[model samples]
Target: MKHFIQQVLYALIASMLLLTACTKSTPIGSELIDQDQVELKFRDDFKIIAKSINVDSVKTYGPQENEQLNSYLCGRYEDPVFGKVEASIFTQLALEGAMLPDFITKEGTVILDSVILSLVYDSTKVYGDELALPQKISIHTMFEALDRADTYYSNQSFGYSPNPIGEKTFFPRVRDSL
Candidate 1:
């Protein structure tokens, strides 16, 4: 009985030790990025066409509705407190004939770089008189390929939208200025 007890005690200690070793380290401020800067970059310059929205399961994405619908299903929505989301993305590119198995971007920021971002857009009909293109957004794009450890931007997946003012024909995310 004592031998069985000792074995159990040893197992418990081993388990505890393993748990301690497995604990992951907390991330530092390095990963944090400024969303305002990205927005400002577009607000200031405002000219990058979005090519596509690559996701984990390319198979699931469809063209019938496009990125807007995709964003809605994923988890983006307009909340009184959070503001507009999912609606924020305005794509000049069509969802039809899009390639599969492409991780074009999983997470992104508003700042400048290879990728660009634009939270503001025209709320008119799907094909209304508007820019009709997604701003090139910077994903967790590295400042330097050599410094793979270093990152410039961070993403939270979805954005918030403010309450709508009128029964306007415009969609939600299309902000007036940008």
Candidate 2:
């Protein structure tokens, strides 16, 4: 019957498709290359001649032509190409909101317990070896105030108290969360 022939044809096509779908085929061009015969080698040593140069003072405060920096660098490391490099940071501390009237009124009665500081690390911009010795960081109160109108530079120096108000020494954890 015509109906029986149509059903048979449908079954035949379905079985054919099922057979192809269940079958696993090898990757294309995988048989063309032999893994044992292929060898990979690299050279790590090379004659590199370089010299360190004095760089000009970098803008450390405010915005440069409407551009502002999101982060700053502070550390000492030895580079293979640039040799030894050291960096320091200078920033102004500020309080949030317009003012605290309650704290101002009870300033003398308020007892100071402790002060805390938090810093976020930029892992992607890390330089030098992470396995190197731990770095020491000290925070001191500046003798002079940083003016927003004045442009600060990397070569610029500021006077601070000889004693450190806070200090911390830790290893650089670039990949891990600090």
lDDT, candidate 1, residue 121? 40
lDDT values for all models: 0.39, 0.77
Q: Write the per-residue lDDT of candidate 1 for residues 114-141, one digit (tens) a residue.
A: 3233344434433333343343322232
Tell me how far the alpha carbon of residue 36 in candidate 1 is from the true structure, in angstroms, after superposition.
Answer: 73
Angstrom error at residue 154, model 1: 22
Off by over 4 Å in 2: 1-50, 63-65, 80-82, 97-113, 175-178
Please give the lDDT score at residue 91 for candidate 1: 22
**Candidate 1 lDDT score relative to the true structure:** 0.39
lDDT of 1 at 36: 46
Off by over 4 Å in 1: 1-60, 63-113, 122-174
TM-score of every prediction relative to native: 0.16, 0.59
